[model samples]
Structures are given as structure tokens and as C-alpha cells.
Target: MHLLAFNGSPRLRGNTWTLLNQLKRGAEEAGATTEEVILNKQHIKPCQACESCKKTLVCRIKDDMAPLYGSILSADMIVIGTPVYFWSMSAQMKAFVDRWYALDLDPIRPRLAGKRFGLVVCYADSATETASGVVYAFKSAAAYFDMRFYEPLLVTAGDRNDAAGNPQALQAAFALGQEIAKP
Candidate 1:
């Protein structure tokens, strides 16, 4: 199986990326092909509600997102990793999610149906409430694509690099990856 993980954190080596790396390691060990896309480094534009995708089943915007559509559709599983910002996803992550509207338009509805989906989130606050909103956001997006949602793995950290060298979060991320890769 192939898995594509999208890192929505702007920080290159931030908590979110660290956890996602652990997940990728586990998937690789499981003999599954895995790839990571750093959204912040890509030139993806937010949907403009142009309704072009409804007609052509493709977005009209000539940007990085055009290439991602094939990868998203071809993946057996997809993992989205983001850092919580003010009890919600970061703006960079939100922009990536908004582009999914192209895949939701007519003739492209359920483009990712039946694919497995996983969520990984990092929050500055230790309280679960701080992660609740982001979790809902992932759930809603998964539902829209008719994807099967897997249990989300969340890590609470007091510092930006809290995920680094953290064995527990790393283990959880690896386990989540294994589960997603399993039949």
C-alpha cells in the first residue's frame, strides 16, 4: 500500500513534522511506500469557488495543488498532520483543506472514497479541549470525501519541540501508521 502524509505546519522540524516522521518510519517498516508533502513549502492556492472543477473534474488553477490531486487519489491511505493554532488548525493547513473543494465538486464527488484517513495534531495546551476543534475539522473533511476515518493520534506539548525525543508520542504515531497500513 501507499500512504501520503501532508504536513501542514510551517515549521520544518516542528512537533507536527517530528510526529509525522515517526509515522512514516513505521509505515516504511511495514513495507508500505510513504511520502510526505510539506504544504507550507508548496504553492497551493485556496479554492476560488470558480466551479471549474464541476465541469472538468479538475481545478483551473495552475499551481502545486494540481499535481497533488493525483497523489491524493492514488494513495491507499492519507495522513494529515497539523499544529493547533488558537484551538483550530493553522492557516496554512486551512488553505490546503479549502483546496479540497475541487475534489468535492460534481463529477468528482467522493474522489477519495474508501481510502483510509488519519489525523495527527499537536497542541500547546495539555487540555483535550484545545484539540477538540481540530479533531472535528478532520472528521468533517473525512466525511466529505467519504473516507474511512481512523483514530486520531494527538500529542500535547508545552514547547514547540516537545515532540522531539518524546518516546510516547513517537510510539503512538508509529502505531497509528501501522494500523493504517494494515489490511
Candidate 2:
């Protein structure tokens, strides 16, 4: 199986990234090949909302997001990791997610119908408000695209590497990875 992970946090070494790595290790152990895309570092522009793509059957923007369509189609599962900023996901994550609108219209969308998607969210707050919006949005998007949604792994971490010390969080991430990778 092929699993593609997107690190949606701008901080490369933060808790979001930490959990993603742990999750990736579990998937690797389960015999899945994986690839990671650091969304913050990619030059993906926000969706223009132009109707042209609907006719063209592809995103017309000639930016970094051009090649990701193939990656999404090739992967059996897709994992997105992000830090809760304000009451929702980071801007980088939002931008990447927004660009997925065209994927909904792609001619190859049917071939990717069952692509599994999971979210890994790290937040500083104990309250649900910190990450619930992100959870709902990703879930809703998966539904719209007909992708199977895995249980999200939400970690309440206040520090950069808190996920490393939180055994429960790490274990959940690892299990999530394995769950998606296994037949």
C-alpha cells in the first residue's frame, strides 16, 4: 500500500510533525511505502474559484500544486498533520485543503474514490474548540470526495515536542497509521 502524508504545520519540528513521524513509522512497519509533503514549504496558491477548471478537468494554476494531483491519485491513503492555530487549522493547511476543490472535479476522481484520509491535529487547549472545526472540515471534505475517513488522532500538546512524551498520543498515532495501511 502507498500512504502519502502531508505535514501541514509550518514548524518542521513541532508536535504535529512529531506525531506524523510516529504515524509514518507504524505504517512502514505495516509494510506500506510512504511519501511526505511539507505543505508550508510548497508554493501552492489559494484556489482561484474560477470555473475554468471545471471545464478543463484540472487545476489550471501552474504552481507547486500541479503535481500533487497525481500523488493523491497514486496513494491508497492520505494523512494530514496540522497544528491548531486560533480556533482552527493553520493557514498553510487551509490553503492546501482549499486547492483540493479541483480534485473533486478531476476525471480521475472516480479512480480515487476510496482513498482513505486521516487527520493528525495537535493543539494547546484542553477544550474541544481548539481542534473541532478542523476535524469537522476534514471529515466533511472526505465525505464530499467519497474517501474513507479514519478516526482522527488529536493531541493536546503545549510544547514543540510534547507528542514525544505523550505515550497515549504516540500510540494512537502509530495505531492510526497501521489501521490505514493494513488490508
Candidate 3:
């Protein structure tokens, strides 16, 4: 099985990346080939809502996102990792999520059907508000694509990089990965 994880945190070694790496490690140990893409470093354009994909089943922007479409569709599991910003996901993550609109064309809409989706969220505070938006976003995405909604892996106190090293957080992340990798 193949798993694709998109890390939307701008900091390469930030808390979000650390948690995502934990998930990746578990998946790799389970014999699943995994790739983690750092979305902030990629040059992906926001969707223009031109409605062209409705007929062509493809996006017109022509950027890094095009290549990801195929990989995303083929992957058995997909994970979105991002840090909470203003009580929601980062702008980079939002751009990528919006681009999924391109997959709305084919008769079997949302090429992600049957795939398992996992959400990894990092937040600065313990307040549930920070995670609420991202959780909702993941749910909506899963619903739209008819994909299985795996339980989210959330790391609070994410304001600091060392937060990811917390024993409890790491344990939770490992457990989440194991659950997602289960048959």
C-alpha cells in the first residue's frame, strides 16, 4: 500500500512535520511505502473556479498540483498535516484543499473514493477552537470524496517545536498511525 502525506507547515522541522513524520514512520514499519510532501515549499496555485474542470476533468492552472492529482488518486491512504492558524488551517493547506475541486468532474467524482483519510493537526493552545475548524474541514473533504474518515491525530501545545517530543503526544501519534494502517 502507498500513503501520501502533505505537510502544510512552513517550517520544515516544525511540530506539524514532527508529528507527520511519526505517522510516516509507523506506516513505513507496516510495510507501506510512504511519501511526505511539504506543501509550503511547492508552487501550487489557488483554484480560479473557472469551471473548466467540469468538462475536461483537469485543472488549467498547470502547476505542481497537477502531478499530485495522479498520486493522490492512486494512494491507498492520504494524510493532511497542518498547524492551526487563526483557529483554522494554514493558508497553504487551504489552497491545496481548494484545488481538489478539480476532481469534481468524473462520473465517479472525487477520485479519492475508497481511500482512507487522516488529519494531523497542531495547535498553539489547548482550546478546542483551534482544532475545530480543521476537523470540520477534514470531515467535509471526506464526505465529498466518499472516503473513510480516520480518527484525527491532534497535538496541542504546538506553539513550540519540542511539543511534538512530548511522550503523550508521540504515543498518540503512533497509535493513530497504527490504527490507520490496520486492515
Candidate 4:
């Protein structure tokens, strides 16, 4: 099995990254080949809404995102990790999500169809509900694409790298990864 994780936090060592790393470890232990894409290090341009890819199956703007398209398409499982900002996902993850429009050129047929989807979110607020929008976005997309959307792991009260110190959060991430590895 091949699992691909996308870390959408700007900070490489932030809470979001910590959770994703733990998850990756678990997936690897389960015999899945796991890879992580750090969005901050990649030059992924925002979707221009030009709709060119709707017919060509390619993006007009050529950059680091070009390679990720193949990764996203080939992965058996996809995990999206992000930090909650203003009751939603960070700008980086949102931009990445927007670029997925390129894969949805056909309303009935999506490139990521039938893949397993998971989400990991870190938030400062005690109410993890603040990340509901991010959850909804993934859930909606998964449903539209006939993908399997797993229950998300939300780590609340995570500031900076606080999640690294939270044993429960780390365990949850690991467990989620194992679940994703199952056939």
C-alpha cells in the first residue's frame, strides 16, 4: 500500500507536522510505503480558475505541483494535515485543496476516486469544532469522488509544537494511520 501525507503547516516542526510524522511512522510499521509532502517547501501556485485542466488533465501553471499530481493520483491513501486558523484550515492547505479542482474536470469522474482519505488537524482553541469546515471540505470531496473518508483526528489546544508533548494526540495519529493501512 502507498500512503501519501500532505503537511500544510508553514512551520516544519509545528504541531501539525508532529502529528503527521507520528501517523507516517504507524503507516510504515503497517508495511505501507508512506511519503509526506511539505507544502511550505513546495512552490504550489494558487489555482487561477482558468479551467484549462478541465480538458487537458494538467495545470497551466508549471511548478512543484506538477509532480504532486502524479503522487496524489497513484496513492492508495491520502492524509491531509493542517493547522486550524480562524476556525478553518490554514491558507496553504486551502490553496492545495483548490488545486484539486484540476482533478475534478469531470463532475462524475474524479482522478482521486476510491482512495482512502484522512485528516489531521491541530488547533489552539479548546473547541476542535473550529476545524469543522476543514473536515466538511474533505468529507464532501471524498463523497463526491466515491472515496473512503475516515474519521478525522483533531488535536485541540495545540499551540506551536504543543502536540509533540501530547501523548494522547500522538497515539491517536498512530492509530489512525494503522486504520488507513488496512485493506
Candidate 5:
């Protein structure tokens, strides 16, 4: 099986990236062919609200997100990792998630249905508030697409690489990865 993970953290080697890699490592150990995409490094434009995807059944903007369509469609599971921003997921993650609108078209919905999903969110303060928004977003999307929602990992006070010091969060992320990899 193939598992795709999107690291939406702007920091290349911070807490979010650290947890993302840990989770991916567990997925790899679980025998899944996994790939992690660092969203900040890619040039993915925000949705323009042009709604051109309705008739064409594809995003009109040409960028890195185009290639991701195929990977997202074919993957058995997906993991989203991001640092909290404004008590929610990072702006980068929001854009990427919103772009999934292309796949949510009525005719194309099947491409995303029944897949599994996991969330990894890190924050500096009030983990509850930061994680709640992100968790709700993912859960709503999973429900809309009939996908399985795996347990989420929230790292509190992890503005830097504080999450790496939290053994519990690391183990939880790894376990979630293993769980989603199971048939």
C-alpha cells in the first residue's frame, strides 16, 4: 500500500517536521511504501475561487499541486502535519487542504472515499485551542469523504523542537502510523 504524507510546516527542521518524519518512519516500518512531501518547499498556489474545476474536473492553476492529485488519489492513507497558526493549522496546510476541492467534485468523489487519514499538530501555547481547529477540519473532511479518522497527535508547547522531547507524543504518532497502515 502507498501512504502519502504532507508536511505543511514552514520550518524545514522544526518540531512539526520532526514529528512528521517520526510518523512517516512508523508507516514505513509497517510495510507501506510512503512518501513525504514538504509543502513549504513546493510552489503551490492558493485556490483562486475561480471554480474552473467544476466543468474541467481539474484545478486550472498549474503548479506543484497538480502532481499531488495523482498521489492523493491513489494513496491508501494520508497524513497531515502542521504547526498551529492563529489557533488553527498553518496557512500552508489550509491552502493545500482547500485545494482538495478539486477531488471533492461529485463525479470525482470516489477517488478520495474510504481512505484513511491522520493529523499531527504542534503548538506553542494552548494545545487544546490550536489542535481543536485542525482536528475538526480533518474530521469533517474525513466524514464528508467517508474516510477513516485515525487518532491525532497534538504536541503542546512545541514552538521549537519541544515535541522531540516529548516521548509520549512521539510514541503516539508512531502508533497512529502503524494503526493506519493496517488492513
Candidate 6:
């Protein structure tokens, strides 16, 4: 299986990054090849409402996002990990998601239909409320995109590397990776 993970946290060593790495380890152990893209590191322009891709199956803006379209198409499972900011996903994550409009074309819809999608959200606050919007965004997007949505892994980590110290959070992420490995 080919599993692709997108890390949307700006901090390269933050909780979101740690959880995604642990998840990657589990996926590799399950005999799946994995590729990861850190959104913060990439130069992605915000999606314009031009609607050009709706017909052409391509984005008008040329940048790092061009290649990810192929990666998304090739991967068996696509996992998106992000840090919650102001009760929502990070700006990087939001931009990445907005770019998905390119794949919303009718011809490409079948390619994504029933594909597995996983969400991992990290926040400093212990309350689930802090990241509910992000969770809902992924959940609703998965449904609209016709992808098989898995239960999200929501973790609370106040420190940058706190997720690495939280065994439960790590295990949950690991389990998510393993689950995605199944056919």
C-alpha cells in the first residue's frame, strides 16, 4: 500500500509532526510505502476562486502543489495532520485543502471515491472544542469527496514535542497508520 501523509504544522518538530512520524513508522512496519509532505515547507499559493481547474483538472497557479496532485492520485491512503489554531486548522493546512478543489472535477471524482482518508489534529487545549472545526472540516470534506473517512485522532499537546511524550496519542496515530494499510 502507498500511504501519503501531509504535515500542516509550521513547527517541524511540533506535536503534529511527531504524531505523523510515529504514524509513518507504523505504516512502514505494516509493509506500506509512505511519502510525507510538509505543507509549511512548500510554497503554496492560496486557491483563487477562478474555477479553472473545475474543467481542466489542473490549477492555474504554478508551484509546489502541482506535483502533489499526482501524489494524491497515486496514494492508497491520504493522511492530513495539522495543528489547530483558533479552533481551526493552521493556515498552511487550509491552503492545502483549498487546493483540493482541483481534484473536485467530475472525471477525477471516481478516482477518489471510496479512497481512505485520515485526519490528525493537535491542539494545546485539552478540550475537544479547540479542534472541532478542523475535525468537522476533514469529516465533511471526506464525505463530499466520496472518500472513506476514518475516525480522527485528536491530541492535546501544549509543548512542541509533547505528543512524543504522550504514549496514548502516539499509539492512536500508530493505529491509524496500521488501519490504513488494510486493503
Output candidate 5 Cα RMSD.
1.2
- CA lDDT, candidate 2, residue 146: 90
Clashing pairs in 2: none
- State which candidate has the highest TM-score: 6
For each candidate in turn, the TM-score is 0.95, 0.96, 0.95, 0.95, 0.95, 0.97
lDDT of 2 by residue, 101-138 (tens): 78777576686678889899999898766789999999
Give me the candidate number with maximum lDDT: 6
Off by over 4 Å in 1: none
Taken over the whole model, the C-alpha lDDT of each candidate is 0.88, 0.88, 0.84, 0.87, 0.85, 0.90
Estimate, for each residue in 75-169, the C-alpha lDDT of model 1 and write its tens digit: 99999999998899988888888888788865566668899999999987878788899999899888878999998998987576899868899
lDDT of model 5 at position 162: 80
Q: What is the lDDT of residue 39 in candidate 2?
A: 93
What are the RMSDs of all candidates, in order? 1.3, 1.2, 1.3, 1.5, 1.2, 1.0
Candidate 4 lDDT, tens digit per residue, 1-183? 999999999997889889999998888888899999999888888999998887786789898888888888889999999988887888888888888888776742566778999899888888867889889888898898789999999998566769988999999999999999876
lDDT at 92, model 1:
82
Instruction: For candidate 5, write residues 1-97 as lDDT tens digits.
Output: 8889999888878888788778877888899888889999888889998989998999999999999999999999989898888878888888898
lDDT of 1 at 114: 92
Question: In model 4, how large is the Cα lDDT of residue 115?
Answer: 90
lDDT of 3 by residue, 14-123 (tens): 88888888888887777777899999988999899898888877899999998998888889999899899998899999999899888776663656788988998988
**lDDT of the structure predicted as candidate 5:** 0.85
* Candidate 3 Cα errors over 4 Å, as ranges: 108-110
Backbone clashes, candidate 5: 0
Candidate 1 has a TM-score of 0.95
